[model samples]
Target: MLELLIIACLQDQCREFSKLYDPAEVSLLTCMMSGQSEVARWQAAYPEWQVDRWSCGERSTRAARL
Candidate 1:
């Protein structure tokens, strides 16, 4: 999955994004870097998450949900 994600990032943006994982939440930055369909890729990555949903580009709120 990391290799696939790196491929997507390298192909799409020529930039790098870091990865961090938690038992509770996922990162949108990680999702965008993966270059798969935004919604589908994210859900697939963390099928067991029980928290609320979220997205990137939010400000002043730490941007995490649930």
Candidate 2:
């Protein structure tokens, strides 16, 4: 429902995010942690957006950024 629309927006805006990050997904993760209301809404829509406690000192590894 709303997630699809939000993801579409993210996909469209990915180019902008990718500019600062070689892989824009990093920015996605960081963007979440940046603490905005949208992040919560997004998380509510996608509970799996971030693995439980994934950011607790865990290195991002070489994940393929969507």
Candidate 3:
């Protein structure tokens, strides 16, 4: 599934966060189109924070070793 990545900050305190779109979009075009609303929702929740940048991509998974 794809995820929407967001980098936002309150003044100088920066943080990175992401969420997977419900049901998931198949292509980057779809992701980009839908990402705006997702961003808006995030902004509304944290009005004080400013969004530095955002994008959509496949979710990253950490490898496990024995």
C-alpha TM-scores of all predictions: 0.25, 0.25, 0.76
Per-residue lDDT tens digits for candidate 2, residues 17-54, read: 11133333444455445434544555677664441221
lDDT minimum window of 10 residues, candidate 3: 57-66
Q: Which 10 residues in a row give candidate 1 its minimum summed lDDT?
A: 1-10
2 or 3, greater by TM-score: 3
User: How accurate locally is residue 2 in candidate 2, as Cα lDDT from 0 to 100?
Assistant: 8
Q: Residue 7 of model 1: what lDDT?
A: 17
By TM-score, the best candidate is 3
lDDT by residue (tens digit), candidate 1, 1-66? 121122123233433222334413545466455434654555467554322333333233344422
Clashing pairs in 1: none
Candidate 1 wrong stretches, greater than 4 Å: 1-37, 58-66
Candidate 2: regions farther than 4 A off: 1-35, 51-66
lDDT of each candidate versus the true structure: 0.37, 0.35, 0.81
- Predict model 2's lDDT versus the native: 0.35
Error at 8, model 3, angstroms:
0.1
Give the TM-score comparing model 3 with the true structure, all chains together: 0.76
Tens-place lDDT digits, model 3, residues 1-66: 677889999889988878866444367678889889989999999899999999998765672212
